[model samples]
Target: MTLLGDAAHPMVPRFGQGAGQAIEDGFALAVLLEHAKRDKIPARLKAYQELRLERTSRV
Candidate 1:
């Protein structure tokens, strides 16, 4: 299974991005999944990770 937001990268309370990041992760994953083939799940997830990691790391 794939992880998202706090589950993937929990942050200190001061960051105040737990919910927002979760939402962003879910939305991005959903969009990717929509166009992804069943056999391409791994690739899709990797894409999601790369996309979110770049954005979340800055938080």
Candidate 2:
């Protein structure tokens, strides 16, 4: 399973990025999954992680 939002990148409540990041993560993952082949789900999930890790870490 994959984590998103606060579960993925918990931050100080003052920063207020938890919901937005989660939404963004969900949207991005959804997009990736939508275009991925049935047998490529794992690859797509990895791609999702790679795609979000850098950005999330920065936040």
Candidate 1 global TM-score: 0.89
* True lDDT of residue 6, candidate 1: 93
- Candidate 1 lDDT by residue in tens digits, 1-59: 79997999897877568988899999999999997778999999999999998899998
- List model 2 lDDT by residue over 1-59, tens digit each: 78888988897787678988988999999999996778999999899999999999998
Tell me how many clashing residue pairs each candidate has: 0, 0
In terms of lDDT, the poorest run of 10 residues in model 1 is 11-20
lDDT of 2: 0.89
Give every collision pair in model 2: none
Provide the TM-score for each candidate, comma-separated: 0.89, 0.87
The list of candidate 2 runs beyond 4 A from truth reads none
Best by lDDT: 1
